[model samples]
Target chain A: MERTPPHPEVSAFDLQLVLEALVDPVRRSIVTQLAVTGEDRACGTFDLPVSKSTATHHFKVLREAGLIRQYYVGTSRMNALRRTDMDQAFPGLLDALTTPRAVAR
Target chain B: MERTPPHPEVSAFDLQLVLEALVDPVRRSIVTQLAVTGEDRACGTFDLPVSKSTATHHFKVLREAGLIRQYYVGTSRMNALRRTDMDQAFPGLLDALTTPRAVAR
Candidate 1:
């Protein structure tokens, strides 16, 4: 039986990759948008005011950093947050990073 | 009656810089070592298994990323985690990233 390249194993390097990937504000916004949508979304769907080239660069950065998994679902490439891989690598890490804290009354 | 550089100013970009800086495993290990020491240590202090050039490269990456502040303290250079600037930029985001979790029984 042929074994598929089991999802790239997670390590401290992978953790770093994910952290660095989400560090950009634009990327963070993309992730927030993805999370709110609750499913994969096309790169162009985000209303980022940057130029098309910049947007593409940002998406490429996000993809290379391992923050999001992108696959061709027909002509459009779908992008979704890699929450499962991230959670497995560092449990509760993604939640803590993305969760919004309430302001003091 | 003049002000120093006024701390380069923190923003989302700065957050990205910090995140990218700490993403490397070698750099992360250095940060952990610094945190445990609680006092700035010389670059030569850490017994990194990498070559001198590689160690220097790692230190440069850390410095450029804004995760740690390096300054010349006499004949030796001192390094400390930029916890204050980072905390201001994203609140408890750093703690969430660095805290280790215990495995469940």
Candidate 2:
């Protein structure tokens, strides 16, 4: 897998990267999974219907956007939502994006 | 001087486009200016230091990302923040992003 060194220019308000990173339903699903589990999960753990290549692409987008942090923990790349960074940057923006809508039965 | 017709696939939650469009400080300045003015502004009105071409490109990015609505209202194109649409999609997100932080002297 590819890794990018941190750039000082990348700040919390990099809105385009943030937006583009989260545009996919699958990525949203991943976020929800992280939130629900309340813990970081390995990149391979997500049961996405798409192929591994697509999953890798989504993870890369999220990582590049600074929404999630990925690092090698053994052979697996563990992923965790960068809640603290996001909350500090935009403060409550992530909560709005991930809130579950009430469904009427 | 190009206009894109409305597309059904264009939803407010298209996060990548939204993030990319707002990444530029000039665009954020435009949004803040729109918020401060509390009214729609013409494309030519924003006194950005950048060239007019760059301003137009920024506007196009915002428009494509569904962050702002643009329409011709005479010779100039009028622009307004799509606050309502953003609220519906990710309620309270814009407020968080645009909130003025308290500074102590």
Candidate 3:
């Protein structure tokens, strides 16, 4: 039997934790991709520029922050944005954070 | 001569930097207070539990992240939320971030 990783309950979502998790560029990119895809993506599907370990760390941060839900599918671990959970906690926060903009910096 | 601190232009606002600044609880509290007050506040006015230096550090973080603007008023430094800039950059992000919540965590 495959064990699922623990994630914070939607009601237990902490704004600070969520913000922290999204602060990193890689994590923000991941969230944006998930938001656009609207589906679970294998961890390896993300075109992260970091090493596998570093990528794993970013996934863990997102999961612990309750920003994403992860589950195992066969040999691959798939991740999806917890959009409903985030919306419940912070309202339009996810949309604002993920909306594409011409970043001046 | 009173010199206003430099802040990233509204068009230059970066989501990652803003999230990084808000990730800190103390900084978040400061932003919340500013949001509620809708006016500039003196640095000494915030009821932060940290040391003066720590509070100063947090303020600098907020200012540099383009989340807030700071300027001198006589001997005191006043800080104000960059609401216009933030909104221009992230739309409803500020409201979502500052809205009072039950915070199940």
lDDT of 1 by residue, B1-61 (tens): 1121123445523545556666667777787777656778888899788987898788777
lDDT by residue for model 2 (A34-89), tens: 87677999988998889988998898888777788887777888888888877776
lDDT of 2 by residue, B6-91 (tens): 52233435655565555566787787778667799998999798998889888878877777888887778899888887777657
Error of 2 at A26 (Å): 5.6
Error of 3 at A89 (Å): 1.4
- How high is the lDDT of residue B56 in model 3? 88
Model 2 - which docking category?
Answer: acceptable
Of the two candidates 1 and 3, the one with more favorable lDDT, higher being better, is 3
Q: Per model, state how many residue pairs clash.
A: 0, 7, 0
- Give lDDT tens digits, candidate 3, residues A1-105: 337989898777877788888878889889988988898999999989999999999999999999899999888999999998888878888878767662223
Off by over 4 Å in 2: A1-20, A23-29, A48-66, A71-73, A101-105, B1-20, B23-26, B49-61, B101-105
Q: What TM-score would you report for chain A in candidate 2?
A: 0.83
Candidate 3 chain B worst ten-residue window by lDDT: B96-105
Model 3 chain A poorest 10 in a row by lDDT: A96-105
Stretches of candidate 3 above 4 Å error? A102-105, B102-105
TM-score of each: 0.59, 0.64, 0.90
The two-chain DockQ for each candidate, comma-separated, is: 0.22, 0.25, 0.64
